[model samples]
Every structure is written in structure tokens, then in C-alpha cells.
Target: MVMKVLFAGTPEVALPSLELLAGDREHFEVVSVLTRPDAPSGRGRRLMPSPVKEAALRLGLPVLESDPSDPSFPDVVKATGARYAAVVAYGRILRQPVLDALEGGWYNLHFSLLPQWRGAAPVQRSIWSGDTVTGATVFRLTKGMDEGPILSQSTVEIGPDENAGQLLDRLAQDGSRLLAASLEAVGEGRARLVPQSPGAYEVARKITGEDAHIRFDVPAFAADRQIRACTPEPGAWCLLHAEGGRDDTGLVLHVLRARPLPADDRAAPRDLPAGRLARTKRQVWVGTKSNPLELLEVKPAGKKAMKAADWARGARLADDAWCG
Candidate 1:
């Protein structure tokens, strides 16, 4: 007998799990999908369906476009007749009657391991902190923030050069497979959920523009981590500093891509002081406490993204161009 599954998600990160369940004919049937309603998007702020909603429509799955805060939410969930729900980045909390609405249970696929970075934006937080290890968790959905018992977990290495978007894409893919297997285990009545250890969890707060601000006073490695974590959203940026001037003047330059300081450059500040920018014919670099960080792509205010070296050339900066 195929189990009827209700899918709940809101962003592109959740698409993999939705697609995986929908494609499986032998085990689970995705009877319906619950996603956030159309919201303003893009530069024009026109109404647009969420990525999950768009994909759900493409998959021919019924979509419940409602928030948990709605008075009719529990009734709507009950109406679907899908006792079990698979949630991934649903962007809302499931409350009492709503949790009770699904008799079987609600299982969430979180982007971080339980008791570690348990909140929204786990992937971004992990990178910002220079955590070399992180993973995904499939767990029961409780009223608490990812405090439910763990159904399963899959550990993954944080690639040295990978950004938040890149790491998230990888986790979503890998987590989909893990979720499917866990669901299969549940179906076979062989699933065992383990309770997480108590009271040692870390918080993963959402990234703000200030959180993404590049600080040249930090070491090159730390700066690299923060930059990669904020990439592609609320982008990591630094203020343009005129020679011998402070960065308080609001001249911002968004850093789209950065490379690790090469071994040869790691110990050498060269002619550049901390927060200073300079470039050779082949590369652009920004000085840090430890070394100069290689700058690959950047976008000055009101400008399109371009190679950092090109921007430097066009600006015709002095040898000690400042970018604090």
C-alpha cells in the first residue's frame, strides 16, 4: 500500500525532497503540497509564486497556499486526508491543532544536525563561523525550534571554497535522498528515532547586512568564511576607502566572489596595509590582518558585477587603494 504524504515547503531548497517523493510510485504518494502564497519578488516587487508552489503545480500536486497563522489552517490540513507531512524549510511554525491535524506526524528535514545550529539559516551560520563540519537532519516536528527527536542525520564536509548557495544546493540534494530513505524505513516499521543530547545547541540566527559586512581587521581566513556564507544573498560587502581615509563615507562594494590567499601570499602584506586594495596585472587583492585576500568578482554601488581587477584598472587607484 502506498502511503499518502503531504509535502510542506516554501523555497527552492525544498524542491528536491518534493520531487523525490512525487517521483516515487512504489512507496509514497505526494497527495498535496503546502506552501506560502504568492509574494512580492524581484526588483519590481511584482507578486510571484514561491518556487515550491511553481514546482508543485508542475508536478500536478494540489497546493494549499496558506500560512499556519490562518484560522482555517488546521481545518485545511485535515481536509487533505494526508495524515503525514514532510516539511523542509516551510518558513513557519506548526502549532497545536495543526500538529494534531496530521495524526501520523510531521517530519522536518532541517539543514543542520540536531543540537547544533538549530534555527533558520543554519547553512549560512555554519559557514560564517568557519565550521568545517555540518550536516542535515530529518526529525520529528515539535513546537520547539528543531528540538524534536532525530529520525536520521547525514554528515557532510564543508568545502573550503564553497559559498552558502553552493553548500545549500549540495545539502538539499543529499538530504532528499536521506529523507527518502528515512521515510522508507518508517514505512517498513523499522525506523528508530534517537533523542538528541540536552542543552548544548547553538543558535543560527538569520544573516543581516551588518552580519555580512567584511571586516579587514579579521584574518584572511575568517573574512573568507563570512564572505562565502553571505554570497548570493545579502551579499558580503566592504566600504571603499580612499587612501588614508576611513570607511565611514558609505562607499560600498559588494563582493560576489573571493578566492583564498595563495600559500605564497598568506604571510606577506607586501606594499598593502590592512583594508587596503591593490592588484597585479592578473589578480586583485584586499589586505587583511593575516594576508591579502584574492578578489574575484565585485560590484560597486549602482554597477553591474565585474572582475575585481577590471574595476581596479578602470578606477586607476593609487598603489594603496583602501577598501575597509
Candidate 2:
């Protein structure tokens, strides 16, 4: 029998799994999708539907909305007549009443491996920690934040310089396939949730704007990790300080791409003074406590994102100008 399933999620990343399961109608029936409602967006502040809602409409599936903690939410879940639920970045915690409404169980597709990075910002945290490997996990939904029984998992290698956004994009795709397989296995009576061992695991706390500030006073490698973790989200930003330029207190310099230069063993000290900006014809490098970091792409204040060299050429960077 095709499993009647309730799909719940809110963001663009959720679309892949929803589409995957929707296409496999013979095995899983997506009775309805539960997602956060539209929110005001853009300069006009017009209400815009979530990516999941947009995809659900385009796929001709029923859509539902509710706060999970609402007392009457159980009735809403029961109304769908769904035995199972699948969630991907649903953006809200599931209340126990909602979990009790499903017979097969609620399965969550998380970006990080189980017992590690178990929280809202797993993908971002894993990259920041210099983890060589990270993956996705499909686990049974429980009250604890991402503390659930493991159903299925798949591993992925983190590229040497891959930023959080780029890595998360790949994980979302890999995770969609893993989620589908886990649900299918359950339908085949092979669902076995390995109970997670009770222990202290790394918690992936949310990445905030304050956390995105890059500190060149630190080792180049450490600063590199901080910049990469914030890329394409809060974004690695700095205040520009130039001798000839106007007071740059309000000038924001966005560093889109950068890498730490390998320390030279022959040199007495790896690199020069920290925070100083230096440039060549084709590249811009920022000094750190150890080896300097190469700034690849940057968006200077009131400028479009471009190669770091291009920004340097236009700005005619002051000799003592530093990034803070």
C-alpha cells in the first residue's frame, strides 16, 4: 500500500525532497504539505509565499499551515489521514501532540551526521570546525532538538575551500535521495532506528551577524575558517580604514572569497603585520598573525561584487589602509 505522507518544510532546500516524493506517487502519497505561511519581502514589503508553498502549488498538492505548538494541531494532522510525515528544514520544532498523530513516524532530514552538529546550523558549524567530512541523516523526529533515532545516513566530503552556502547546497541534494530511501525502507518493513548513545555532542548553534566578523589578528587559517563559515549568509564583512579616504566607520567591505597563504618555512616569521592590506597587479592579500590571506573576491562599499584586484584598482587603496 502506498504510504500516505504529510510533508512539512518551508525553505527552497525543502523543494527537492518534496518533488522527489511527489514524483514517486506509486510508493508515497503526499497528502498535504505543512509549511510556514508567507512573509513580507522586498522593498515593497509584499507578502511572498515560501519556496515550499510555491513548489507545492506548482505540483498541484494540497497545502496546510499551522503553528506546531497550537493545541488544535493534532486535529489538523489527523484530518490529512497521513500515517507518516517527512520534514526538511521545517523551521519550527514539532510538538509531541503532532508526533503522536502519525502512526509510521515523522522522519527529519538533517544536514549533519547524527550525534554531531545536532542543531539549526549544522552545515555552517561543520565547515567552520574544519571538518573534513560531513553528511546528512534521516532520523525519527523526537522532542529533543535533532536528537532522534537514526534511520539512514550518507557521507560527503567537504571541499578544501567550500563555503557554508556552497556546501549546504550539495548536502540538500544528497539528503533528498537519502530521505526518500529511508521512507521507502520503512514502507518495506525495514525501518530500524538505531538509538543514539547518550553523550555530549557538538551543538550547531545559529550563526549570527556578530559571529561573522573576521579577525585578522588570529592565525590566517583560523581567520580563513571564520570568513568561510559566514560566506553567502551574514557574509564576511569588515570596516575599511584608509588614510586618504573619508572616515570609513560606515563603509562595509564584504569579502566574498579568500584563502590563507601557506606559511613559508624559510621565513623567520610566516608573514608581516596583521590587518594591513597589500595588493599586486592581479591579487589582494591581507596580513594575519601567521601567513596572510589572499582576498579573491570582494564588494567594496557602494560597489558591485568583483575581483579583489578590480576593487583595489578602482579604490587606489592607501598604503596604510587596513581591514578591521
How much does each candidate deviate from the true structure in C-alpha RMSD? Answer: 1.9, 2.2
- Tens-place lDDT per residue, model 1, 280-306, is 676888888876788989999999999
lDDT of each: 0.87, 0.88
Worst 10 residues of 2 by lDDT: 263-272
Question: Clashes per prediction?
Answer: 0, 0
Question: What are the clashing pairs of model 1?
Answer: none
Model 2 Cα shift for residue 323 (angstroms): 0.8
- Local error of candidate 2 at residue 37 (angstroms): 1.2
Which tens-of-lDDT digit does each residue in 276-297 have in candidate 2?
A: 8887778788889888888899
Q: TM-score winner among the candidates?
A: 2
- The local lDDT score (0 to 100) that residue 134 gets in candidate 1 is 89
Which stretches in model 1 have alpha-carbon errors above 4 Å?
A: 242-248, 266-271
What's the lDDT for candidate 2? 0.88
Off by over 4 Å in 2: 244-250, 265-270
